[model samples]
Target: MSEARAARPWLALLAGAGYGLFYLYAIGDVTLYGPPHWGAYLTEVSLERIFTARSTLMFEAIAVIELGWVVWLFSPLNLFLALILAGLLAANMHGVLYIRAHPKQCQVGGNKAFIGALPALFAGGACCAPSLILLLGIPGLGAFGALFGWLLPISIVVLGINRIWQHGHGAPSMLEYARQRFGLNNPSTA
Candidate 1:
């Protein structure tokens, strides 16, 4: 393969490995903190009811799905995974936004990953709001929770659109230092 072609696979592998590390870290944090037990969110409900083993199992299953997507980032299937991953990222963002909105409720320490993962958690929440509503029995909370659940996706979509507008138009131009650091320029050209 040409050098550029060869580099693609290695770059993909690095991206996958990075995502996997991020996933593991996020799951570990959630397990350690037991899912943000403050406010009127579904997380609070889950904690209040002491989510059944089945519910916990389902949650773990979702985490595994996310991990799979992260791993797939190394493969040619990354394009497909990127869309879903973006939604997950958005959900994380939503979580962060929630925490920011309710500063008194956040229990996160100074962990950099925790700070970074907040936005992702929010984005993930937005992406999965419908499922969350169904699983949590949204109707039981009457109109308020139902309205919140219904609005979640719209918010996420808007956030995504804004992000795309802000960052999607540019093509990368490598600086000499960046080319050296990432080994990204064409060897023959150099």
Candidate 2:
């Protein structure tokens, strides 16, 4: 690998880490990982949603399917929703990380920003939708919470779209470049 190529992933890492720490201290304070009640990290199904569930056999089935889809398509989460979202995010991150670490793979198609946004929007930000944020004495964090809530999720979307555009334009992602430089290309060997 060339010198510049070697340095690129570190740059990504540095930027990612810096942003992570900033988000961690700024908005992540009230989150589960921070000082708030550990339970704050968790999301539970709303009683209202359960009660409002559609009736009728077919409609119920459709509603179930729709509910599942809506949960994944959106960033909101409860206990079940958290599990489902975590599973999907884990799978996606696994793929993205594999592509980054593997030598053979050359495309970084997944948006890692989602990894950050999930925690921010769901556990750390406005969408926490629970008393966790309220428990924290710092009302100033409300602004941080709101900002990161929207910013992180929106960044996830923008980054995803940007990745697609970059790939479409034949640009190599940092992961792809790093894979070609340092990672094994073969899956079997992995």
Candidate 3:
């Protein structure tokens, strides 16, 4: 894989973690319980009237109103969260395609970094903190979501760098590097 493609997953994961931090702080408490409250800044005469206007198009109304609502709230946290989520979804899609393309390779390491993202994302959520603490039986763990947030990305980054280095030193690629690193280099019996 090209360096850019190799780096894409790591970059997306880190970006998601950063946006998760934003979600944990400024906007998380207020942004998600329901639709944003209508603002006088958006409506022509009144907030309710703007939403009730006859000019609102069926197909475009949701998009326009949502955008207006976010802008009316005047916080970029939602946009940051949205973009980060899009990046993560794209990365996971790429990983899925990679797995489909490389059937001969062992499945264990192929998309593990991608898989690690699920828990990493869970730790990002405010509500998941308690579950993580409960499951691990650590009292203060819930308060460290931000720290746990970077763990997956950082581990992926280290592994990616190691793979790139291995490839540079004449190992074939990350798959080959993983096989060797994990002593899975034996020929496949299948």
Residue-wise C-alpha lDDT for candidate 1, range 1-190, written one tens digit per residue: 4434422433434544454344333323222333333332122233423332222221222111223113211221222333444443443333333333333334432243245554534554453444455667867544443454334345345545533322222212223223754677767796
TM-score of 3: 0.32
Residue-by-residue lDDT tens digits, candidate 2, 1-190: 4545433455545545444433323322212222222111223355444434221100111121122212111112222333333333333333344334432343443344334334423432333322355666666665654343444344344445544544443445555555666764746556
Model 2 has a clash total of 4
* Candidate 1 lDDT for residue 81: 34
Each prediction's Cα lDDT score? 0.37, 0.37, 0.41
**Ten residues in sequence with the least summed lDDT for candidate 3:** 55-64
Best prediction by lDDT: 3
Model 3 residue 107 lDDT score: 42
Q: What is the lDDT of residue 66 in candidate 1?
A: 24
**Residue 65 shift from truth in candidate 1, angstroms:** 19
Regions of model 3 farther than 4 Å from truth: 1-30, 34-36, 40-74, 105-190
Encode model 3's per-residue lDDT on 1-190: one tens digit a residue.
6534543445545655555444433332223334555443332344444344221110111222333334223223334444544344334433433443443452434455346445434433433343346667986665675555454344344434433432333334434434544568557742
Which segments of model 1 are wrong by more than 4 Å?
1-110, 141-181, 186-190
lDDT of 3 at 53: 24
- TM-score of every candidate relative to the true structure: 0.28, 0.36, 0.32
For model 3 the local lDDT of residue 58 reads 7
